[model samples]
Target: MPLTDAKARNAKPKNNQFKLFDTDGLFLLVSPAGGKWWRFKYRLGGKEKLISLGTYPEVSLAQARARRDEARGQVADGIDPSQARKALKAARVQNESTFEVVAREWHTKFTPTWTPGHAVTIKSRLEFNVFPWIGERPVNEIKAPELLMVLRRIESRGAFETAHRIRSICGQVFRYAVATGRAERDPAADLRGALPPVKPKHHSAITDPEKVAGLLRAIDSYQGSLVTKCALRLAPYLFVRPGELRQMEWAQINLEAGEWNIPAEKMKTRQPHLVPLAHQTLEILRELHPLTGTGKYVFPNPRTSKRPMSNNAVLAALRRMGFEKEEMTGHGFRAMART
Candidate 1:
């Protein structure tokens, strides 16, 4: 007879473990310790085998019988219920190892090789853009169409170049998943030319020696704050990036050695750079030293020494002196010196 809920609950343990039989090979195994577990005994391939359906109360009488019937169906179809259960368990484990989890792992592994700014940018892009859509989904189950939907949202925001970069990053992540046996293929690989092309922007610069001399003369006659004036004068000589020059510190300069050693962390190339100071550059520094030598930054903010000079100060000064942005920018100093 099939076990009723009231009888199963009242069933007590004896001296040893015993089985309370139900129809179709289903039974409740009552242990000596008073534990009641549902079990299904069956024969497959000329061998007898048994599997646990679940525990009493949790599996209940009706649910346990339903699971037993499902397993019996599989057995009739020449399938082993045990093997099918194992396959389902494996798939559940793989699903828990999601795309977001793998992508973040990939980010952590590769961030050490990138600059701090680059690392932050990459992380922010993913967290704000990609993670919300398909992050929780299984990496192996993420098809090309779903990934394309994510990229199209980014492209819709007018960040065409960023969309392309994100696709490349997704490809790297997918390839990493493949190497780790989590995914079969990179879905991003099929997205070639799927986004719009990036437009080229060239920084404007005046490279002629006569024109450069004229620029220097204009900077000298300007009546702006002395800090900005100093930066303007030093820009042409150092030819360092605007950011590098603005963040320059007195500690990095060696007056006796006539060198400016920029640390690797501050450099875009991730290598320390030595700028051999010309006599003219040294003299300019000497003149400005008495005013700002005690501060952390050589070109500290004009109003207060708490921060470095504004990045736009030099550009704004050039505009004040009647130079258009199309003619010369603060970054143009490098190309001008290069020419």
Candidate 2:
């Protein structure tokens, strides 16, 4: 007889396990420990076989019958229902392993070796440029043309350099996917020379000694935050990269030793650098000391002491001093020193 909801729910466990048979090979197996399991029994290739449907209360009577009917239909069509279930599960797993998933895994694994700023830039590039386009696709199935379409989108904006950077970053991600056995090959590799090369633009500087001296006098008499004015003054003297100069920590400066030590992670070459302090530079530092000496950064943000000054602070100061973008920039200090 076919089981009903009442019969199935009211069924009790016995000292030994027993089955309550329903029609169409569906039954409820009540175990000795009061556990109820719904199971399906069928014959295939002239041999009887059985498979689990679910649990009693969880599967319920009607749901168990539906599942049993579905499985019997598969057996009638000469397909092993268990094997079909396994194949469906494998396909689902494959669908979940997407390019974004693998790329994020790779990013997390290698982020420890990169500087914090570089790590943020890498993540930002992928999130803004790559992820929205191809992130949901399975890593193993992504093709070369698909990746090129993504890069071409970046190129369409006249950002040739940014396009090239995204391509390199994608290449690294694909290589990581390959090394981890998720992808077959890097599609980015097939895109060699596919984008226009970026032209090198030099920072503009006032190379004439008299103009340089004039710029210095302007900085000295500049009307700005004392911290920004100090940074402007030190830029020409130290000639460190603008980033390194802005991110300088008070702990790295040795006023007594007359030097500022920049750690390797902060430098572009990833090597530690030492800048010897001149007497004038030392005097400027000593004068600025009392104001910002208590903070972690030598030039902390005016709004918040936790972070260093904005990267635009120096450039904006130069702009305020009547220097056009084409004439001079914060990076111009480096070129000015070199000349």
Candidate 3:
């Protein structure tokens, strides 16, 4: 007989488990503990098998009958419904594992080789750009279109280079997922030529000897602070990165040896660097030493003298000297010296 809701709900439990047969081997099993379970009794390859559809109320009589009909159709095609159910459940678990979960796991394994700042930057980039859009989606199920949509949002903000970098980062995460069996393939790898090209932008520099001379003359006559004036004067001689120069510590400079021994941590490459000081550079350092020698930084902030000089100090000085941003930046000294 087909089981109705009232028949199943009013069914009494006994000292032993009992089954109220519905039809075609679908029945409601009422346990001694008063729990009702919907189950399908079936046979495959002439051997008997049982599959649990769901519990009562959750799996109503009509829903259980529908599932039974579907399973019956599968059995008619000689497919084992129990095995099919197991595969579906496993797939569901895998899908719930999620992109964010796998990406974070990949990050944890990979961050050990990265510097603290680099690690923080990568995590921040993912959280800001990728997380809100599709981070919760299953990594394996994410298609190229979905990822391109994420990149497009970044592109819309005019962060073309950032979008490219994020694509690369996502590729790494996807590859990690693939290698670890969390995903089947990298969707990001399928997105070649999808983003805008990233052009290399070199810092503007005065490389011509004549223009360089003119720039030096302008720096000398600048009416900025004496400390800033000295930094501007010394920049051309040292020719290190602007941040490296501004964050320079007194201890790193060997005025006697005419060399600045930049520690690996302070350098962009994470490798120690040597900057040979010219005679004029030594004189400038010696002259400025009296003013900032006692402080931790060679070019301490003018307002406080407790920290390194502002990152904009040299750039602002260049602006004041009539060198437009396209003409020069604090970083331009490297190219100028290289030239």
Candidate that scores best on TM-score: 2
TM-score of model 1 (CA atoms): 0.68
What's the number of clashes in each of the models? 0, 0, 0
Better of 2 and 3 by lDDT: 2
Q: Per-residue lDDT tens digits of candidate 1, residues 121-175?
A: 9888889889899899899999889999999999888988889889998999999
lDDT of 2: 0.90
Instruction: State the displacement of the C-alpha of residue 319, model 1, in Å, after optimal TM-score superposition.
Output: 1.8
Q: For model 3, how does the per-residue alpha-carbon lDDT over 20-105 read when each residue is reduced to its tens digit?
A: 99999999999999999999988999899998999998888999999999999999999999999889988887765688888888
Write down the lDDT of every candidate, Cα atoms only.
0.90, 0.90, 0.89
lDDT of 1 at 297: 92
Clash pairs, candidate 2, are none
Compute the lDDT of residue 32 as modeled in candidate 1.
97
Question: What's the TM for model 2?
Answer: 0.69
Lowest lDDT sum, 10 consecutive residues, model 1, at 91-100
